[model samples]
Target: MASDQPARRATIHDVAKLAQASTAAVSRVLRDAYGVSDDMAARVKAAMKELDYRPHASARGMRGKTYTIGIVHPDLRNTFFPDIFSAVAEVILPTSRQIMMATSEWTSTEDVFAAMHDRRIEGMIVVAPHISENKLVEAARQAPLVLTHRHSYSTAYDTIVSDDDAGAELVVRHLAELGHKYIVHLGPANGRLATQLSFVTAKRARAYRNAMESLGLGKFAEVAGCPHYTFEDGYRAAHEVLTRSRRPTAIFAGTDNVAFGVIQAAYDLGIELPRQLSLVGYDNTGTGGLGPLSLTSVDQNPHEIGTLAAKMLLSRMDGRESVERASITPQLVVRRTTAEPFE
Candidate 1:
């Protein structure tokens, strides 16, 4: 039901002419670059809307003005990335580029690459499970690349990651501070590539052990269920914890959604949070601050993570460096979910 008359893709001159301005000014409005007045920008946008002027994809390819960046997330079903993605877009506004997204959902990287390649994205930001070093290098060979939540395995791209080891330690230390004698860690399921990392799930496990030993409560440190980063996974794990004879006094989930589900499970069992048992989770994904949940968690700052990753990718595309890496420290956010161990 659409016209095939070349689709009449609007050009910068069209918008400029309609707005009674120069093409450079219109370009500035489109790029959100330096020195465009608010009135000018509004007029340009209005003209663009009136003309139904979509920037031509092929023309953009000609000028390398695709003005688009692809972000590969874990899954959109989880609310985590929406917030982060919005933040990244906000930061990119000044740079005049738009954001696009893809998700692996723990799916195959080959599938991710095929989709990205077919789309002809100018550059990409991949946040995948533990991917092979060679596979990531190959993907970078195709386009400019930046990785989120994973470390750089090769010099082909940049990496933006959080201090997950310290994050794990924070959870255990919080439980120790609350006088918890026994603590159980609910981590990612073993199937994903992330779980196989020397520095991710493995690092968290090691950090938990170190923290427990430091508190002289190593015997109480137990690795419980491996949930697949979901509320339902957390819910099921909570049931297992509740059934334990010497149940952990506190539970630490690797992510916030998982913690939310654990809280729900505890409520259903008539267990009092922070009373009969304390709860803690990672990734302060807004949900932790809800009045009912108020989950104590580690702030992985996903928005900051996204913003930083985009900057890294852009820098690489600009030929700033061959390989660069950055790390963010995760902070503990204390709320109502954790309390002193009850007698």
Candidate 2:
């Protein structure tokens, strides 16, 4: 259905011509060279985007750097993911490079890898990739890559992850401090890969159970979860927990999106949050900041994560390719959704 003849990709001159800016002015804006006004930079970027102008990597190759990178995110719908995406954008914007984004499900990373194959994309930033470790290593061999959220000691690629285990412990300890003996851990059952050492949810779930048992509340420790990380999975997992013979007084949902589903299910069951059921979510996403949601969650500080990942990829693209790993600390933000269990 498409034309066989390849269309001409827009060029930097086209952007400069349309923006009414000189070639030097356009170059300075893209390279983040000093002295470009905000207005000038904005105008150049807008014109470039409008014309779909891509600075050819081939031309930059003579200068020993490609002006393009690819970013693959976990999911498009998850509010938490977009924050990370923007963070990556902020970090790369000033470097005179471009970022092309794509979404990949926990089930497949093919769409993401396809972006990597583009000749223009000299480096990749894969956020919370759901593919296997083996596949990741192969991909890294093909291009400079930085994997965020997936943790491993392999020297093949770099990684930046938050302390998810500690984060889960914080939630468990907070619930225990609240006298919530009967607590449930609701999370995605993202198959065997979820059980891998690279997966954050798997780490969090293990930590939650361990923390609860360590507090001598082994009798109340319950891990009810499903295989997918989505709203429907959360609703079903929460519904199962609430419909049990003895419902938990508090719950720790894996992510904020999942917590939203739990909230709706609880509301349908006439359960008031924090009064009848307390909840804590992970990845304090944008939606969680809403007054109505005000979700208590673990803040992974995805901004930091995204920025760090971009920088790491840049380092790799700069040819410093030994291996690097960084961990960002996680913090718990208590909100209106969590409270002391009722009598």
At residue 126, what lDDT does model 2 achieve? 85
How much does each candidate deviate from the true structure in C-alpha RMSD?
A: 3.5, 5.0
Compute the lDDT for candidate 1.
Answer: 0.78
Positional deviation of residue 270's Cα in model 2 after best superposition, in angstroms: 0.5
- Alpha-carbon deviation at 177 in model 2, angstroms: 0.4
Instruction: Give each model's clash number.
Output: 2, 2
| Estimated TM-score for each candidate | 0.87, 0.84
| lDDT digits (tens) for residues 1-343 of candidate 2 | 9999999998888999999999889888877776999999999999988998878667776765567788887777888888887888898877878777777764369656965675557789888777767888888888888988876657888989899889999999999998899988886545664577568778887888789889998888777765566788889999888887889999898888888889999988888999999999999987987999889999999889888888889889778968999999999999899999987
Candidate 1: which pairs clash? 130-193, 130-194
Q: In model 2, how large is the Cα lDDT of residue 277?
A: 95
Write model 1 residue lDDT over 201-286, tens digit each, in one string.
Answer: 66676677788999899888776665466888888888888877767779888678788878888889888988998998877877
Alpha carbon lDDT of residue 78, candidate 2?
Answer: 88
Residue 325's C-alpha lDDT in candidate 2? 92
Question: Each model's C-alpha lDDT?
Answer: 0.78, 0.84
